[model samples]
Target chain A: MATKASRAAARMMIAPSVILLLAWMIVPLSLTIYFSFLRYNLITPTGNPFVGWENYYWFVTDPSFQAAMLNTLMLVGGVLLITVAGGIMFALLLDRPMFGQGIIRIMVIAPFFVMPTVSALVWKNMFMNPVNGMFGQIATSLGFQPIDFMGQIPLLSIILIVSWMWLPFATLILFTAMQSLDQEQLEAAEMDGAGSFSRFVFIVLPHLARAITVVILIQTIFHLSIFAEILVTTNGGPGTASTNLTYLIYVSSLLQFDVGLGSAGGVIAIILANIVAIFLMRMIGKNLDA
Target chain B: MARAVSNRTRALNTAVAGTLGFLMFFPILWIFILSFKTEEDAIRAPLEVLFGSGWTLDSFFTVQERSDYFKHFANSVIISLGSTFVGLLIAIPAAWAMAFVPARHTKNVLMWMLSTKMLPPVGVLVPIYLIFRDYGLLDTRIGLVIVLTLMNLPIIIWMLYTYFKEIPGEILEAARMDGASLREEILHVLTPMAIPGMASTVLLNIILAWNEAFWTLNLTAANAAPLTAFIASYSSPEGLFYAKLSAASIMAIAPILIMGWFSQRQLVRGLTFGAVK
Candidate 1:
């Protein structure tokens, strides 16, 4: 029974959050778009004159932009593949009745809580370092060469580190979904003489479809803008080898002080993120209606 | 629907799951162990370092002595708590309204709020940095608090809305019918009912803000540097000091890790925006 008075109060109550979020979103975004067209460099004290599409042209034509785009896709795709597969396997094992289930779940989910910088550094120096790292020590003791992880395959190393952090997230969500599956359906399938593989394929997987999609969409949003890990580990080093779009933009705008180029890159990143956001928003929108 | 399983099967499952779980958790466990070792022993072969190292709190002491650990820790506490507090202040009213007295466009508003979160922070980094610089807010805790508040507002509102929606409006209407004023009804009825949800929202937001690295690293230089920035500084040649690095990391993540453990179930709900059950 929303009367006129209560409806007015509702409007009043929602105004602060709505207006603040509007300002937060629109103001800086418009400014970024405005800066993308201008030739602005913090280091050079020249006037920021609008240069049409020149900044975008240069940023796009730069070979590094292509590399960053490729690396971004690879990193996102690689981590998604690893985490989703690993998550399913872990979720299945965890769903089975076992001793110390709580402790095992806690251990599996621990990495997700470790901040990116700490996780990256731990992986970089303690585990992946070719010389003084544990891997190196083991390799040397075993009369073999220690694989230079970050140096040899920077993106893959990053992929592994990020996957470790995210696998728990996927597993937790999927496991929750698995726990909610209809037991009668599984019993029915078993009674029909279906093997475990067939039951999993026909029953459990279908039930987990929504949760899998949720995990993928949510993870994609976060994975697309992976920054701190790359920053602390590679700094997109060895000449743009590990630079994602976010890292590329950071280097241009903040590190190199090329505001125009960075803004253009930012716009591109926004567009890329929006492409995925559209799918996510639609999915959530449908869920809301349901 | 109960199925009987043999004891051997149960033991085998436990052993396999435990081993895999330990493997997954070894990095953090190793860091925890190393944080107590001498610097020289921290980098030794894993087997030797685990079995032969003399345990000491030297690294913990040196971390604080060398790098004013408390300052960064305080910064993290202030920023994360401050942002969550401000976000709740703004979001609670909005979520309450949408939940109880939902307008026709309520779903649209919710989706719009979430869309802002989807806008990658990098996209607006240049302008926000310049704006902060012009306002003399760079490297300040207030700036971080403001940014993080905005960054997390959508999630907070979404979570509170989901929680509040679970609360039936008929209860409030009945309270009103019993002659309770609107303010009293909210204070005495709705708020008490929503406490658990709000507490979980606060917790998940704090964890998110505490572990936030991108904005914290980019915005703060020295004075307002949080644990994220503090730990990132150790990423240089000094990162070779495995024991000290481990100590710093353990300190940085300890509070959030505990909080995260408690909030894991809520985290799934919050992160997915209740899209999944």
Candidate 2:
């Protein structure tokens, strides 16, 4: 029902955001693609001659790159497994009538708000330090050797830290979805002799399917580029044990000044992210009209 | 929805959920306790540290004195608030337009905006770094503000759009039918209605921008480092000083944590872009 004037006004109002985003997406991306094909190094700012796919070959073939790729997959997969499972458990429990639910929820959600650096440092020093950490203290009191968490299992340690931060996010989303579930339908199933387990499996799980998908897609996007947690805790560690694609690119481009290799890695990271993004975009797009 | 359950079951459920919640919150609580203890006491065994330490505000003072903490805190406040404010300025009109006057491509525009957010920052790290260096915008607060503004613009617009979508169009139609000009219609009728949504959007974005680590860590050095970068500096030898690090961390996260609690409901909607709801 908008008039010609309002439609024109809408176009005018939308121009700045559209133009800015278009530029924001285009300029740097094209430069990254261009740079990926050249032999560019920031430190030695000499001739940057075009080189075809060599940077990609080297970056992909490098031993650290292989380790980084493995670590990235493990980190993302591990955290998703923990957070999603934990989130389901938490949502189920929280959905039940409980005492002090608000306080408990605040406590649970608090970690997600803590900045990555703070949370990483807190976990690293206060809770995981082998010499003086809480876990070490507990281990020693129980007459066991204190495990060096970051040293022995850097990727696992990161996954735990990240999981703690994100479990709340998944729980909150799932819990919100659960509130919309038909309680009477659940009751009717119970009346029809469905056990609690069967009811949960058949009714609640299906209802939660969409919310779970939303959680997985959104968390994957954030999880794929977990940077500060690794930076502050392990610095991609004892030997790139915890290095993800983002950290690997950061090290090469910013630290090593191999702009070409970093750009190539950046292009690959973009491509991988887009593969996930297409799925997410499709899901969100379907929801737009509804 | 409240079932007729026994008190024993309720109590059992409460205890289990409470314990799990406490475990999740333990690290933050531990740091809070550590922040108030002396450096020596903070490193003691967990039980000993809890039982034997005399509480003091020394570490908080020391964190302030040692690193000029307020400068970084101010930078964080400015960057997050400035970016959110600038983002709102650009987003309000766009969101309003899209919600009220959407055409054929409006949904495409929104989905595309979100797609930009998925473009991992690492993808353009090289060019952005080079551009910032060349333009002398590498370590400036204004530069950080601009980057964060663009970084968060899509989410800001999406959130405002979702919120705006809820406001009925008939209200605007009524306002226009009263011979109100477009400016008067927005200022008198729409802005007031949009204020609460805008406030929640502001709250969520500020929390996001404040805690954003990647750009703040990479783009800023000493002069313009926000709390994220400032806290990251503690990763070295300074990190060994447990009480000081805890104090610094508490200071950095406290404001956002409180804001987060208040905005928890909006967060699900904002982050998921209204899909779950």
Q: Give DockQ for candidates 1 onward, in order.
A: 0.82, 0.84
**Cα lDDT of model 1 by residue, B81-111, tens digit:** 9999999999999999999888899999999
In candidate 2, which residue pairs clash? none
The best candidate in terms of DockQ: 2
DockQ of 2: 0.84
- Per-candidate TM-scores read 0.99, 0.99
Each prediction's fraction of true contacts recovered: 0.80, 0.85
Off by over 4 Å in 1: none
- Position A244, candidate 1: lDDT: 95
- Docking tier of model 1: it is high
